[model samples]
Target chain A: MTATLTRQAPQHAPDAAATLAASTPSWSRRAKNRAASAAVVAAVALTAVPLALVIWAAVERGSARLDLTLFTHSMRGVVGQGGGLLHALTGTLIITGATAIISIPLGLAAAIYLTEYAGGNKLAAITRRAVDIMVSIPSIVAGLAAYALFSLILGPGTRSGLAGAVALAMIMIPVVVRSSEEVLRLVPADLREAGLALGSPRWRVIRKIVLPTALPGLTAGAVLGVARVIGETAPLLLVAGFTDAMNYNLADGRMATLPVFIYTQWSSKGLDTAAYDQRAWAGALVLMAVVVVLQLAARALPPQIAKLRRNR
Target chain B: MMAAASAVALVLVGVLVFLAVNGGPAVTAGEGELPAHAKNFLALAGPLAFGSLWVAVIALALASLPAVGVALAATIYAPSPRFGRFLGAVLDLLAAVPSVVFGLWGLMVLAPAVVPGYEWAHAHLGWLPFFSGEPSVTGRTVLTAGMVVAVMILPIMAAICRESFALTPPALIEAAYALGATRWEMVRAAVLPVARSGIVAGGMLGLGRALGETMAVAMVLSATPSLISFNVISAENPSTIAAFIASTFPESTGAEVSALIGLGLVLFAISLVVSLVGRRIAKQGGLR
Candidate 1:
């Protein structure tokens, strides 16, 4: 490097020029640098291309039908041009709520066990591997497992919103456990030891000191877990039989969900194809909005809360 | 705690046992109007498995190239920290978008938009096996599904890559500059080498996702269980196993349900191999 710089130095006055080593970059090198920077920028642009395209398409196509009817009426009667995803929106809320109920408790318990109790034991080892495997299990396979279990229990063919919730819970469990485990591990051992030194029970120490400290993180993990599976289609399609009519009861009857609604509306479009397609697009738009909000909240809210606490 | 751990472990065992017990009959599944040369479960599963792996590999190639660039642009080439933050936000939103929406966009918009290119390739490069067949009139093909999966998995790959690149030691970067290296040269010496395992790990994560993705692929390729072809743009394209199950399981009755379960079993096995191998590599790379 020095040799090239010295060679490129000016030599007009040989006596005074002791190989002044400040060398100007070649034009080719500068051009290459500029081109490389541009290429990197272009690559980032390409990464953004899909998000831009998907949003643009959804907004342009679904905008006409994106109205309040999405939450007002079901798609039971109206067919030609006016129908809403009332059942779907409600179904999404119900099933996702149930999924959270089942998953958060189980996942939190497992995470607590792994981090607070289990210290490289056999059951912990098995659970860790299971969680890892669960993370990779395909959504459809998870759906099928729920399907098989339900079939074995409730006759040959049974589909319910509850079953769908079970399927989603299976998918959400690993996510919840993983994130919660990380948060739990971050709790200072000193706090737990301090609690023990104060003559408190282990469970009391955990519930009083540890859980409160980790509550914000746990909420973020659980909310993110819900967001992750809220738009799931394949699993719900298998377990939650779709219906256009309102079926509020998730115990036994079929339930509609946003993703499956979009799928059904688009694939089973009747004579008024444009109308069905429009409804599907509308459904997609709403689902995207909900998911985007949840995701942003989970990632964005925790830091701000921490900042506020620090300021206070 | 013990109960919770046992519950998870039980579910894992149960899924495997259920698939195994129910799926055994799939091997000799001959009750339906079996397509010629597809008398058994292995034959039935061949095309779907091939399609699954083939589409995933294509998506891996397509997403990884741009993902590396995104990482570089964010960490090294960003003109400002704000640019990197905005880029990260955009990617998080991209990941937040569900796969079904991607499917809708791919089928409704991307496929049609690219039909002309598919036709051009078919007409011009017909001698090549990939473009040898007639273009799909509706534009739902393996390649289209691959493109959709690529877009769906891109955010994950890029995020992982960015995280890996961010961990490169500052001293290493300064040394490259001290040696009078150009910015690109510094990256080549200090960044890429350190992040190579991470890049591979990120690619593998995306691969695992693409392999398992159902809705995007299903919504694009109208399932053709019997046909097997490599012509990516043709009307006839191999469909992934997940797509096959999603299409078939809903309406299946009698023995066909068992066959579908067998397909799920095959998928579970495939995913098991992929997940284990991927997790090992990712651990080596040391970034999620």
Candidate 2:
């Protein structure tokens, strides 16, 4: 859903008269226009100010002690002086990688079903609507859903990185579906028609022609889906309780994530409160860096890849 | 493919079904470890649900005017199209930042930053029940949480409104201008008429988000298990269901966990209703 920044509506109607009127407007109309513009600009400032502040805070506070040690040592049983987020870094990567693994294919298949086979089918529409609604469901609900499902299957108190990954996957799936559907819809119908004319079956056409044509966009969409979920603290904190030590096994005991690490570091303060605060800020900084990079890639890569395809 | 689509469909149902299946025992037992204020399920849920909706209402109210202003700036008021798109992207950055960061910022930076303002409001508007209490010494109040959620949802509402606003027929705008309408009047006649449903739908969606939002409220508000906060700036603020569940679920045992599940299910139901209605409105408005 955060992919929307890159995927705005395709239709941009250029209105020439709009430019001309502003230049030669009547005095009263010009004054009114100026006032309204000023108000809207103020609103934009109001919204942007908070973002600038948060990013500034994250960068300023986080860079103080961000060093090799943060990535080298796990914060296992150390009070403050010597510790790192090796455990959290591995845990977040593993869980999110697993989340992507699980959600991407299921989402791709659902997108293909909706685009190629379902057509205007009623069940398809309901299914599509369901997916759309699911996009806005609370992230915590996903955590609860995963928690309930796993607890039922594994009995009470089943906490694992796998459960956390599953929770994140639940959130990511709908996002992947929505973005994949958007990109899939952009494939030229004539391409599919040509494939069909070449005696290929429908599935063959989708697999060969449609998928290749929309490959870059699909990748971008998947990346954006991951970006959306990577910083999720609520769900992971819910299903995968935090641990200080390194735990690589998905089905093993509680695992730490960067976001949850940031949360826990602040809440469970130690004797050295400043150390904990610095760790939290550094974690936030690292997490923000990853999210921003993924976001930029999601926005920038598709067009470049499309251009490459075109040049080829 | 069918199975994949069904998986998506199933998850939507599974969220509700699991909440019901796991939480049913708690409701049947109807007497377990709940918050100090709650004697039964309804007592536990009623105030929490109300608090959640009320806080979201405050947030929506706070956000709607500025959100529309943002949509208008991006769609009709920008000097150039490039500027509008840039502004939109900047807004999206707000959405991309995780809520935990916002929570930490709220608790650390924003809460203290607004203490003087809260004291001023409490001093001036002390006669009003809603502003009567001595301002929270720590500045972590329902009002502060509302401000945080308002900022969080502003972009969502603005994005939806920007989509619909951009779709306003250029011909309609030109026609209004041709009829000698002032800039504000033209926007009122053309853009507002076209994007009204979008504004309403966006508000509902934002409300849905604000209601279910957990981290900011959990980390910011100094809330207790109480009836709804009549005085939003008071330290004795009410906890939202989502925040309550987040704080409670970590250590909860047997019936208590089930009760938290029940609370979450109630949250699910309320937010589900809001989002479904939002979807219905968006469909009616023909927003994608």
Going through the candidates in order, the fraction of native interface contacts each one reproduces equals 0.66, 0.64
**Could you tell me which 10 consecutive residues in candidate 1 chain A have the lowest summed lDDT?**
A15-24
lDDT of 1 by residue, B162-253 (tens): 98899899989979876767888788899999888888878877888898899989998855766677788999888888988887778876
State the displacement of the C-alpha of residue B281, model 2, in Å, after optimal TM-score superposition. Answer: 1.2
TM-score of chain B of 1: 0.93
Specify the poorest-scoring 10-residue window by lDDT in model 1 chain B: B30-39
Q: List the residue pairs that clash in candidate 2.
A: none
Model 2: lDDT of residue A138: 87
Model 1 residue A119 lDDT? Answer: 95
- How well does chain A score by TM in each candidate? 0.89, 0.88
